[model samples]
Structures are given as structure tokens and as C-alpha cells.
Target: MVRAAGKHTSARLVLICVGLLGIALIADFLWASSSSSRFALIGANWAPPVSLLTPITIPNKGVDSQKNNTTTGRVLSATFADLPAPELKWEKMAAAPVPRLDGAAMQIKNLLYVFAGYGTIDYVHSHVDIYNFSDNTWGGRFDMPKEMAHSHLGMVTDGRYIYIVNGQYGPQCRGPTSHTFTLDTETKKWQNMPPLPVPRYAPATQLWRGRLHVMGGSKENRHTPAVDHWSLAVKDGKALEKEWRTEVPIPKGGPHRASIVYNDRLYVMGGQEGDFMAKPGSPIFKCSRRNEVVYGDVYMLDDEMKWKVLPPMPKPDSHIEFAWALVDNSVIIVGGTTEKHPITKKMVLVGEMFQFNFDTLNWSVIGKLPFRVKTTLVGFWKGWLYFTSGQRDKGPEDPAPKKVIGELWRTKLNLGS
Candidate 1:
């Protein structure tokens, strides 16, 4: 009888061991499948170090409390705002040659030049797609110089020339590169410029007072914010200085922020403090979301080279470093990533068209977009506000988007009521 009891116990132990082994095998298979699928999509040989389903580790603090307190209390919304219709509609135009995020766009007369961006999961694009506004068609495509970084680039144009600054090179959150280049729109030629002393990811770059000023972007680690402000003397698409000169650092340092020169004053607005970081010991630089603090804080570099706090945006916005247009006396911003939802804690994307009136020193929600999207390239031409190429959400409520689109949409700029 004792022997029989012992045999039953042995059988139970064997079954439990087999069950545990089965569970382990399933987990391993799922991880491998996830890694292989990403590799297959990007046609890369390296394996992913982190699973895409890994939960992001956010701090206990709420996102609404993330704004810079120094600048939050000074500004108020305009009492008599010029608001567009809630159901404002847009008309679709030509589709982009490549749908992308993290790309840059510049309108040179009748032509819109779109730069390199992330085309697919882990795939970085290195081509320029040109859209002609004269005939409303995609005119041509051209390859970027091989030295150019594929994504997270800082691009700005001076009428006939487009200048690209330091950005993330290659794919999968790779290290930032110091390479800089300029493209002549008239000749369609590329020229290498003096590299940045410190490469930064998505720095706010603009031409101000005959110098290319670059400020506030993530450091080489892909997460640390950089406050190192530098400028190089440039004239007529040529670098006049051999090295960048140090300038006054921004009060808030981060990337994916908008910087523009209005009335000869530099305004930097709407950026986040934290960004994705690569896992330690990752061979392929597998990326994961870090604890981020998005802000609507706006800072201005006055003529005296001093930083001044300005009115913040209507909400904490980011991913809009290049998604802005200077329309008349106001700066118009399209879609971008906003703070996470309060209840669900999921990331939220901005759908409304926002305008910051330089005349009134106020902000107003001017219009609503067709849908919520992020990383869109915007241009204003002939009274039309055009946006193209970005990731789109499933619906108004859904924060996660499964599709990237190249469809161009436009609305009349004068339709504000």
C-alpha cells in the first residue's frame, strides 16, 4: 500500500514538471516570434533585445503636473478668440511617395521637399520626395547623401536651401551623428557642412541673424536632455564659421520641440523631457519608452540673448518640432502627441489645429483635424494649409495607431470664424 501511494506521488510530480516546462517553452517561442517578426519586417539580421509588449514604467506623478511651473501662471487664454468650426473639414490631395514619421518638410516656392524618416518598424528611409503645389502632384524622388542620418533629423530651409543638422543615424534608436548637410533647391545639389561639436537628436534648429542656431535635444544616450546651445555663422547656404560658437543654453532642454524666429526673436515651444532609451548591453540598441514629462512651456530668446518665459500652449504637446507654420501674424500648429489620458494612462495625440497669435500674445484652438495623428509635415501655400505623411489613429478614442499614411490633406486658411 505504501509503494502504491509513492507511485501516485511520483506521477503527480511528473505531470507538474511537464506543465512548467510547457509554459516555459511557450514564453520562449513567443519572444522569438516577436523578435523574428520585427527582423523580417525590417530585413535586419540582429535580434530584438526587448519585447514590444513590455509595459512602460511611469512614475507616480501625474502627467498634468509635468509643466514648468515658472512659466505656467503668467499667461491666460484669449477672451475673444477666433475659433474655427468644430466640424471643420479638409480635402485630400496627392499621396506621399513614402509614408513616414520623424521626417522634415520645407516649402520652396511651389515645391515641397520631404526629407528622410522612419518608413517601417526599425526601417530608416534615406530619400527625398518632392511634391509640387503648382500641379498638385508628387513630382520626383531623390536619394539623400549617404552621410545623412535617416531619422530624427533637424531640418530648416532658407528659401532656396534646406539644411539638415545632427540626428539619429541608421535604425533602432542608434546613436546620434554629427553630420550636417545642405541641399540647394535650385541646383538640386548636396553639400557637406561643418559637423556639430555634439550630436543631438531632433534639436531645435533655425536660421536666426545669419547664424544657424541649434538648441535643446537628447544627448547620445537617447534619453538625457541636452542644454548645450550652439550656433554657426552661415550665409547664402555656406558655413561661415569652422566651428559652432557656444550660446546661452535654454532653460528647458529637450527634443521634439518647435523653434521659430518671429520678429527676429527665437521662440522654442512644446517639448518633452524624456524619450526612449536603449536597453543596457543591447547589441542592436533595442529601444524602450522611459518616464517622460511632456510640457507646453514656451521660451523665447530675446534680442539681448537672454531667455524669457512665455505663455504655454493650450495643452502639453510634443512630437511637433517641425509641425508648425507661420501664417500671417500667428503660428499654426497641426497634430502632435500630447499627454497621456488621465483614466487609462495611455498616450494621447492632438487633433486640433492650434494658433498662437503673435499680435495678441495668446493661444486659441483654431480648428479640428480630420483625425488624430502625429509627426505630420505642414505647409501653408496660396491660402491653403496642407499636411502630409504621418501615423493615424483608429478612431478619435483610440490612442494607438496601426497605420501610417501618406495622404495629403488641406483646408482653407481663411476659413476661421
Candidate 2:
């Protein structure tokens, strides 16, 4: 994996120029779609503020020596180190082609699936990219079915199909689409699913047991994000063979990001209370001065759908979030900026990655991610966590400073008990 620190001096300039361009492009695409089945990208807030990118180089890693690193007979195990804590080096297995930033990624079997993300403010892409670990090739990109841009799209795999949920669409997220679609892994074909009840973006979804559980996100008409959760059971992927039912509300409040399933429970991290939180605006709606605060704090839900608080995160917190599965009952999360931005009055970038172990009920810092990107897809591939273009926007932080990293990064996760 790659690692690097940002030049604090150039950060402000990048925010304004890049952010404006992104906003303009999103507006242009919302009114149109590609002649092909392809779609356009929906940007997250302005742009991912000053991404903390450490592009992990894959070939440089001695993949040949990895066989000895496997302590538990699990192939490709990783040892995480806190930059300064230990000399724990992450061995890169493979890499992604056309390095895309602020895009979405999902791992099914050894295949990593990538989708929509903003290449720049005015340049949202609807390319469907994929990477196969078994073959180590990154081609096989199919076009998305609609013009859906704006980051923070909820993604989950129902063990059979991959689902892309709602986010901002049409002219910088001016008009919204309750549109839902699924990707047939076998045929690589796109099929539309039922639209969300309310058009919302940056919502959280969990694939548990046999259900696709969707949590709160910012609403279209109202500024308030919801705490109400919906559960869908897929029979053949047409309609929700089973309807949506309510699950537990976020203990702290409504509108949460990064709702992931681990050890029979759903865990959520930082997120703000506003539409397209990736842009500039006040993120506090259902929040208290404290809890409303973008929190690094972690919360949990049991199989019974009960809520409980775990350990709090190492602060300055974030408003957006992404999650992936890990060893044991653990899960890993990346990105989400501080509770507030340094200049534009919006949360810029935190460049933080963390992991939660269900058995231990503990949180640990993994490693710093590369700069200049948001998380669209953060999934497990082989034994490493593969991250793709991740972007989103909430309030009015426009030109919506936007940034897109045209690359992919991977790191090894130490999934030991």
C-alpha cells in the first residue's frame, strides 16, 4: 500500500479550485445520461477535502515472501502498525487499474467490484469496474444503467446480488432519484430494483442473515435525516420479495453513515445531519452539541436488533463513513472528515482508517490512507482491504470543492483474535 502526508500549504487552494469544478460537472450530468447504458457520477460534498493519501505500491511488496507471514493458515494475513508504534509493514497483494478516487467497491469471492465516482467536480463517471484477484486483471467495466452521481451510495451484497442504493443525482443533487439497481455478478448485467420510499442519499445499508437492512440518510424535501431503518429480503431480486421493516434506530440520533454488519450486529460511525453532507453546510440537525458532533464514537446492534455503545473514536471526528468485513467478528472503516472543516466551514478530510473486533469490543487505528479521495468502495480482497473512488456532498460547500483520485490502494488487515 502507499502512504504520504499532505502539504498543509497547498490544501486551501486545492479545496476551492477542485471543489468548484466538481460542482459544475455534477450539474451538467444530472440533466443527461450517456447514449449507452452507462451513467454519470454523483459527487459527495464539494470534494473530498484534502485527502490523506498514501498510495501503497503493490509490486514493491515482496508477495513471494507472504507465504511465511501466514500465522493462522489464512492466506495473505496482514500486520497493522500505527505509523510510529511498530515496524508493521503491510504487504500489498495486487492493485487496481485506472486508479479511481471517490468510487464504490465491493468484494464477492476474490473479485473486487468498482462503480460510479467523481473524477473531478464536473466529471462524474458511471463506469462499472472490476478486479479479479485470481487473475490480477482490472478490465471488464460495464456502463451503469442511469445518471446517478453524488457519493455516499449505500452498497450491500445479499449473498446473491450487489445492490447500489440512493445518493444525490441530477444537477449537483438538485433532483433526486429513489432509483435502485442491482448488478448480476454472473452476467454483469444491471437490473433496477425498487426505489427508496423517500429519495435520500448517503444512507447506510447492512447485509445480515438474509436481509438487506437500510438505515437513515438525509431526506429530499426536509433537512432532517431519519433514524428509521428498513429491512428488505430478496427472493429473486425483482421486488423486495419481502417488504421493508424497521430495525433499531441510531442510539445517538437520525441520519447515520457507515452502517455495517459484523458478528450479527450493525455498527455505525461518523456522519452529519444534512443532505449531501459532502458539501458545505451545518451538519447538525438531530444532533446535540456533543452527540450531534461528528463522532469517532462506535455503536453496536445485536442480532435481536438492540443498540449499545462501544468505544469512542480518537477525535476530531467525521461526517461521512465506509465499512468492510474483517477476520472474526471484526469490521474496518475508512475516511469521513472532522466534525467541522478547517476553512470552508465544512468537514474536509480526516484520512483515518480503523477496525473493530466484535469479540474484544475494541477499536484500533490501522494505517493512514493515501491523499486526495473519498471512499466509494472499501471491501476485502484476498486478505487485504481494497478501497475505490469514494466521494459525497451534503450541504452548500460548493462550488462543492471536489477531488477524484484515479487510482486504487490496498492494505493488509491483521484479523487475529
TM-score of every candidate: 0.79, 0.65
Candidate 2's displacement at residue 78, Å, is 33
Weakest 10 consecutive residues of candidate 1 by summed lDDT: 73-82
Model 2 bad stretches (over 4 Å):
1-102, 147-150, 221-223, 240-243, 252-256, 275-293, 316-323, 341-346, 370-373, 390-403, 415-417
lDDT of 1 by residue, 113-135 (tens): 99888887588889999998878
TM-score for predicted model 2 compared with the true structure: 0.65
lDDT of 2 by residue, 148-212 (tens): 54454677776558887876563233434677778788887778776677766567776776767
Query: Whole-model lDDT for model 2 versus the true structure?
Result: 0.55
lDDT of each: 0.79, 0.55
Tell me the lDDT of model 2 at 102. Answer: 43
- Candidate 2, residue 238: lDDT: 51
Best by lDDT: 1
In angstroms, give how far residue 376 of model 1 lies from its true place: 0.8
The TM-score, computed over Cα atoms with residue i paired to residue i, of candidate 1 is 0.79
